[model samples]
Target chain A: METLAELEPGKSPDVPQVLPPEPVVEIKASRTWLALNLKEIWAYRELLYFLTWRDVKVRYKQTLLGVVWVVLQPLMTMVITTIFFGKIVRVPSDNLPYALFVFAGLLPWMFFSKAITQSGSSLVGSANLITKVYFPRLIIPSATVLSGLVDYAVSVVVLIGLMIYYGVGASVHLLMFPVLIVLMTILALGVGMWLSALNVKYRDVAAMIPFLVQVGMFATPVYYPSSLIPEKWQWLMKLNPLTGIVENSRAALFNRPFDWLSFNISVGIAVLLLVSSAYVFRRMEKSFADFV
Target chain B: MQSIITVENVSKQYRLGTRDASYGTLRDSIVRSIRAPFSKSQSKKGNGVETIWALKDVGFEVKPGEVVGIIGRNGAGKSTLLKILARIVEPTTGNIKLYGRVGSLLEVGTGFHPELSGRENIYLNGAILGMKRAEIERKFDEIVAFAEIEKFIDTPVKHYSSGMYMRLAFAVAAHLEPEILIVDEVLAVGDAGFQKKCLEKMRDVGEHGRTVLFVSHNMSAITRLCKRAILLGDGQVLADGTAHKVASSYLNSGLGTTAVREWQDLEKAPGNDIVRLYAIRVVDEDGQLTDVVDIRKPIGLEMEYAVLNPYHILVPNYHFYTEEGVCAFVAQELDEHWRTTPRPLGRYKSTVWVPGNFLSEGTMIVGAAISTMDPVTIHFHEQDAVAFQVVDSLDGNSSRGDYAGHMPGVVRPMLQWHTEYHVKEN
Candidate 1:
């Protein structure tokens, strides 16, 4: 009865003499557009960890302040923006203290911008690894994005201090903070993968990223609130995925009603960018070593 | 048994100067695409992209536990094939299949960070070379011990001397235990001790029933280490057989020999103001130009040069090297007439003879030079001017009498031997 149970269709009986076959790796010229090779990425997760750690360690090697710089960059930028716009130009902050209000928005903004900037040029910078070693090329930009999370984690502490100083209480909406973080990371990785792959062929992308990030800041309402924009133009503002992220982050912190419409839009755009950019990145990855 | 590796008609084509495309910019590409339909000539040019097929229909198979040497001159696509097998680059056509993990050492310290400590770099480089983190951790102490940098393990590699850096990098690479190992010419660097350690490590890997594909320019190393070899010529496999056979043929290939070299244009010949080299050739006892010499017969190297300066006492010399790159010996003209006396300005031919059974059986590369030893100023020196094959036939007459197997030496001199018979009666 046991032998009969084991004799299933398409199942061969075990052979005692022969060893089990090892995994066969096939190399071919053509690539299926849909083979994102997420399983291989999972297999190399430790390499991703090591590379991300290397990026974090090397970034602050020669710097005087080291990790303090991570906290200082966002803090100082928030102070300067608050003084220039909140004090001089009298920009609105949704009836909250301008510094605390902008700090919340600046948290996700800094991570997104810094991540994209680093990852856009990540492939070109790792030209040696790409040419000499065999690993998923997606891991390069992905490591850049992952490393930025450490910086984001440190910068989040400053937001905590600001909320307490402004007497802003935590609420149920704060649970959405984790969700917003995921959405922001997905968007950054997507855009970054697209840019990094393109940067291999077109170096002009590296030079253009910082400028584009600067322009994107003004467009995303990091210094001001979405309500500050006129009613008719607000819809266009929501088109920028960041607008929903920044606005909803404040909504969650300030205990306002969650903007499900804008949140869903952000989710949609993030997934779309991730899928499409992954497609583009995988399609162009084989030629990266040659072009780089 | 299934082959561990199967490469089928793999080819790679690289566009020359691809980065310098005129339409690299998006605006130019857009404009070109818009106008491509209107102008047949512009479309036909196809952006004028020139390409070279780096590998053309290369095919081979490797059984499990086989150690194969890949030998070729530069630009023969040896590195290209290795790169494709390593998955670093995709072939333009065809495919390959590997049945197990492959670790390729295209370079030492490929991902080594200068700012990282030696200890950190070991793990990082090991991981980059396709070793698991646990595997590196397990072999950590052994690696440090092998590199002989235990005292400075915590110090950043940027501060280590160049030799120490190379040793550490090689040590980490040596510990990679993969099912298939593909190594390039990394043995070319490092000190003799380090290179010997690498060779021993590779031998150990081969003995452990793993497959290895080694590429090296050192003929002796290839012949000693690999049992079989593949020779690539002009991006195609020219020969594939036993290591000694392929290596010897590679030495006799185009770059290794013609047995003759001549400078037709005097102004463009190799020389200085005092002398000019006209020709160099391998000659036999009959004084006829030849490239192959009997192992038990004398061989002569003839050099022709014009002495432009009459008052310079010139010493003409010849250098012989085995195909393994060992300098066999140097012979300087010792004729009393020209030893210390200067000759009048005229064309002169000097020949040096190497006696029978002198050079071992293999290719001998000859270099010719003339120098004045007052301050040792060389008039002209032509390295690899000519090369010839020393053929040892199994005729039972030479030093290797009746021995059909290989003989290992730089020289095989036939020494006089006498035997005295002894009888014991009980």
Candidate 2:
């Protein structure tokens, strides 16, 4: 190998007396919005994978229960929902077993909620990395969403077990599970990207996510069937993208006719939200390292 | 060779304030949106925001294969510039055109998960640094061998010692073969041996016709590994040129000679009633101010002082501090020196000689204090009278030896050496 000395002679002799070049692309947001450069993010896709894997590993490291926490979280939530909502409140489960209904709903809800919560705080949590190094800012939030999938997968197994115990036979519509999962993930990532970017500048978002998720759970059809709502109020229920997701998940599991209208609406809204939120996130990404 | 990276007129501006609540609250945002057109002028005036530009019109170009160092004091926008190049943060203005893949080791273990085994973290870090899966797989053995953590590669990184973790993290980062590599001061934390090794590796990477942008506080390393350097001060490029000259300028500015006097003023000088110091100087035996001090010859510290009282006992003490701020030695004048001596009313002089072979070649500071005793009662006292530098010739050569290049710690003591002849039984 050549020594650094032999490679270049004049460049390191003194501080080069040169001026900086003029900026080519000027970033102008509300001046308050983060100016994320999406082009840069697309350039560093490999980094996103490593960060996602890191989060997955770090989450289970040193824990006695390890990956069991992934399954246990949603499982425990399922038990509570079965006792409180199923027995106490007596919420109608649309002729399906209440435990299985809530479990199915909880699967997507948990994935979205966990992804949102983790991604929202990811920027601040990785302050050291943000400050010291340069990589696509989007990777931080994207990795959080991807890592949450590990837990989502674990929780899905519990749902399958519940279906077996309830003696519910699998239906052909069950093939739609992959599509629903993708829709749920995209929606979660959409909202997560917005929240994470906001959280970097406004810490209140970090503090408010749990309360927002709690309110969101009731707003959607997590514990009750959307059908139970009077038809007049049904339109309002359909407004929540998750309502369509949960109602469709039950339809697929029970061989019921797909709610093509609500399903299409949810897909449309999810795509819209994902696109807008991603744009907003990229817009606000420029100030992340500074504000975080 | 064509330029691999071209940075043109880049500047980043930041607005100082908390995020507005209207954007977060859907109701408030809706209300504001409805009223936006009507109250645009009012809201614009009420915005109450201020903007500060962290970087201003900075530009540079790197040839296909070049190693450049970025040097600056804290908050000089060096990190910001690197972030823009690494694509971690966007510049408010300007553009960076690059020719090939870029890998950055912005911080050591940047993507390491503590729960992940050392082996897993290697792949993760490699991927984060832009290595393909197959590329990392091919370099896995080399990385493990270089890290020297084969025994613990399967252990979780949270359990690995910091040294081991750093080694593994650096190993993965070093194997990256991108067209350009950006590294920050993560190497500052490693042991001296590891630091030297990393520097050598960085030099080798640069030598292999890859470009590198290095940021560090270690002037020696910058001079050794980078051909060119950019000096940033207060978010602007202050200088950019050859590494040695840029480093010298940075050191001169950072380690200003005048600052030494300010430091002396801050520290208490050693003195009491009988004698107090006004100034202290380091001089050779001939009393000339010299930069080089012989390790084997006596050097004098002449202290000029004033006497306050004639009836008290006074003792003088001298403390020596090394470049890394470690106190290496101290000398004191006993009460006997002042017991029978007449108390001079005004100004007086006292000189102390530090015998040769007593100090190592490095920057050092001297502090002196004077105090009086009346039946074990204490009087005036001051510390850090003056600071000085010592340049000792090691290995009987005027030029410092290569062995002294990367030793750790604040002191290098020259101790006794012995040789004996012995016959080995066959």
Candidate 3:
């Protein structure tokens, strides 16, 4: 068993220079509607870093091919999806090769989907940690979303590989890729925050999330371009948020013109969802330990 | 010393079974919507809400540099109060003001991932405990040394022994320099020597002008480490005074004429589907029920229970605690005949005998338990379930030998000592 050295009184070295601890940590029964408590989250930011780091570390530990699984997952999914939906079903790829087209859509979709599922279940997964300590509970889901960025980064390499394989050139519009990635993460966090908060009280949220993700995969343009949809219905598809994100990211990825209208709508919706779900998460975080 | 924590009229009520009127499932919403107009008369139950006030108008203020102990039985809201103070759970009504950073140790090693190495987990657990990255970095070597897992610092914690895991977990938690520390019954874990060290560290934390709120069923800990101890009963502050007064009051409350307990109402009995405690009592050498036993004669504790689930092997045990909350001994029957066999669901009675001339003459609180091994899970554990007193009547037969002032130990075992005289060879 690991045993710490027992420090002798007054003589032992390594006495910590005690900084004045945080002042006035008031725990109340209720707070205002917008008590996001961002400052508290800011103070615990290193916790956010460590939690995200732990997720990334634990995910690939002891695996035969550790982080290669990250790239392999999306690459394989894109292959199977392109063969079935493109080769057999003959879905139009908007003049792009079917492999490159599906891979582009799958990029944001993989990041968004993984982030949603991960952050959605993050609270219940950390039930041990939650009941045992105190922190801004928002850190949990956000950290899960952040860690998914690791896999997202790996998968993006495969996407770029496929694009280059098909002779597609990168444009100045690629500068928008990082911004689109952030928007997709915010969107995932928004939905994840809502679902994880709901998951504590009703386990039904966890069970229902897979179905929601499956339906969302088809609802977005993972298999088919939004151009395949009739013009009248593209606005409804844009309402799904991923439509603008994935299509816009692909436009940037393929050096195509950006859809400023639908893309701006998606950004606005992502920000709104992020803010509202954050409010809802804070509202329900108080009861999490009791229920979870 | 200024008041570090002020809980004002704080009360927390929880719904009996489910979260009330929140997060209703699709099935529930669909059923409720279909039955809405027709079930209006029955809906008067209003979310079918039955609530228990885990805390009720409970209020207290503790000064900085003071160590306060909260003592209560299970369901007495001690855990609830700690959760409230820790902000793990919120009060249903009222408010609390804490004027310093709070580190809550509801359990040790809250965020230790099994797959992570010890070095990584130390940082992760420290961060979870509210320590800054710099703070953890400064104390990293000390934590690794304290956990005594220096050799295994880079090894995965999943392979660490339970002792090593607990040591590391506790080392991280103890080093967190929060202005206020809230600890629960986590001290009940780890071996005796380590627990003594932890208690000593807690004392140091208190003496360093940081406030500590410790909740435990361990009476000795409460009495030794706390200046003011609060006794909670049914979510209310029953008594608040010096540790001796409060602990003695709690022990005395267990002593009044209720050695044998029986519950006719199965629903109200303190058990789950796994096992239900039917009856329990302390008896004399003759196997007759009694609360007071002669110190010179053997005494037996009998616990009868109905095993509701027959699948799991169950071991019924007893923890005998002296009046000061120190465990004298834990006795469980090892009837090998029944060890490997599965018994059908039925009522079973198990009696453990305590030999004569063993126990100190004092009130002993019995904690009865039924649990399964291998996975090591408790089916039902009831603390202070029964109490009995042993009397040494100056018979000169036991170890007391008429030393009338005070018996200082938990058990006054009668040991035979042989002596040989030798000439001094200077």
Candidate 4:
């Protein structure tokens, strides 16, 4: 057989004076243990942005209330919980107004739950992109999680309004609010990535996430303060990662003392889950196109 | 001088039974895990576990600026190899090295949201296809113009017709510039004009010294766009050479084209008691059986059948289809002596001679049928009874005459042209 070079007459015309350097890519058959390849992820950051923007834009396209629903969703839930627990059950609100106290906890809880539910099924939802193109598979779930931040950001306005109505003043503890949000985001990303990866294979993860989130609300300190738990079972509540973030968020909002032990537990578990879940996600990502 | 892409010993294995949706449930996984230890001996016996090798030890090298066509029938591992090269799917065992960025167009409008407008989908689809935001912005106008949807750019894709959606999707994909572009049957969609534009864009990419790997069932398009072709069968490269050579190999290998077919038993033939198809064959001018015919020579599709109870005005017709499955034309026995008269019960032969320079170069599959026109009753219509390869000549005598490039058409008839030069005496 004649080589292509021989079949053609000569070199291609308009060869540039300065040729761009071509990057060499090597693909092998070995199993990937835990290669994050963060550089590739960074290179595709714009795709992550577009995907996130698409999700955010399409989420409320034809809805009548639109962004109002973002604030209304958490606010209505906070009102019912405040009425049921604070008025009927006489749950202590740690000397703060019941509305402000529960609203603060609800903020982080809503963000985490929405992120998990959306990101858990994200891989299955974007199976078209996964099977068609080449990019970091992690971006699909990451985009969904990031899009939830839009709703979270919008709901924060209601938190500030409730604090003002309750005459609660901001304290220096509020400086740690952003740090607590970061920790919450890390935890959400961890669980979201794990569930999304497994959802590619099991598909039961999608069905089980809503129930898990429902159980998770009571497990965390979203409706009631962590102080409501008796000292005997306080260790069990401390085991929940969201317990520290939610409680600390409330502390930051209402000038309550920070729980150093629970905060450190949240930090430890957040980082550990982030690392381990990322490893699992990368391991399962290779076969995602086949199964998803 | 150096090759730009190298694939070594690539193979892919897919588990048989677990491909469907019912297999991947959580309970199934849990049960499998629980039964893993106890079923080890049974698994070792290999009774239930079944796998098929989609690709097996395939290897090739491509230099820069080469356009290669991968041609194969369904389930022939062509798409699997393209997916592996595009990095969308991982091979079971292999190594691949590439020297530049690779762009793969496996499907158009992969992540398009129906709620998003055409303009929004352009950017979104471009990013999903691995184009940067800046690059999409740079070519935004060109994409809209190519799609011919400037007026509807701001309209939601859900409201736009599917043609407009496909056009916008293809426009974005067409503007993507990568060192190596791998396309898999993307040209199979869109109308004739859109497909022509896409083919032109592909040729432009090839001319820019970018290596291209095109997988297509359209033989004419494959021969038109690619200079080299690879024929794949049963997870391996069956032939790799010049485009025409590999295409003929693929066509004559009983994969795409069948030159002759015969029904040995009349009782089991495809027909009722009226008539039955006996045999169908493609023959050259010399009346000899042939699978490949010269473009400048007439070829006949000869059908021999038994007229069992024929007092019917039988129409022996041949439906010719290109390799792309587009019907070229149909020919019936109109000038036969038995056209007005009823046929007596006997075996008869009917031949339809397709004139030289009438058919374009590629595989032509002929479907033979015996039908009556009054009520339009088809006795026996074989879908693909016989097929032949029409080879275009490079000799300046043919219609394409010295161009030596891809001429897009279903027929390449040597139409008459007359020109008169008017020169003023000065």
The best candidate by lDDT is 4
After the best TM-score superposition of candidate 3, give how far the Cα of residue B223 lies from its true spot, in angstroms. Answer: 1.5
**Residues forming the 10-long window of minimal summed lDDT in candidate 1 chain B:** B19-28
Give, for candidate 4 chain A, the lowest lDDT window spanning 10 residues. Answer: A1-10
Clashes of each: 0, 39, 8, 0
| lDDT (Cα, tens digit) per residue for candidate 4, span B65-95 | 7889999888899999998998988999989
List, residue by residue over B214-294, the lDDT tens digit for candidate 2. 998656567678879999987788999988677667764543111122224313544543555567677778887543465
Looking at model 3, how many pairs of residues clash?
8
Model 1 regions more than 4 Å off: A1-23, B17-23, B256-426
Check candidate 4 and list the clashing pairs: none
Give the deviation of candidate 2 from the true structure as CA RMSD.
Answer: 9.3
**Candidate 3, residues A1-292: lDDT per residue as tens digits?**
1111122222222222342344376666786465588888898899999989989988899898999999888779878978898899989998898888888888788888888888888899888878877888999999999999888888888777777788899889999998998888888888889988988877788899899999999899888988889999978988898998999988888888899887898889889988999899988888888777
- Against the true structure, candidate 1 reaches a TM-score of 0.81
Rank the candidate models, highest DockQ first.
3, 4, 1, 2
Q: Would you estimate the TM-scores of all the predictions? A: 0.81, 0.74, 0.80, 0.82
The value of fnat for model 1 is: 0.44
For residues A1-292, write the lDDT of model 4, one tens digit per residue. Answer: 2223233511577322233345367776657796798999999999999999998899888899888889999989888988998899978988887877888888899999999999999999888888889899999888988899888988888788878888889999999998998898888899999999999998889999999999998899877778889999999999999999999898888888999889999999999988998899989888988987
Arranged by lDDT with the best first, the candidates are 4, 1, 3, 2
Output the better candidate (1/2) by lDDT: 1
The Cα RMSD across the true interface for model 3 is 6.8
**Tens-digit lDDT string for candidate 1 (B177-294):** 8878899988867776777777878777776667789998766667667878899987888899888778777765533346789999999999988899999989999998887778
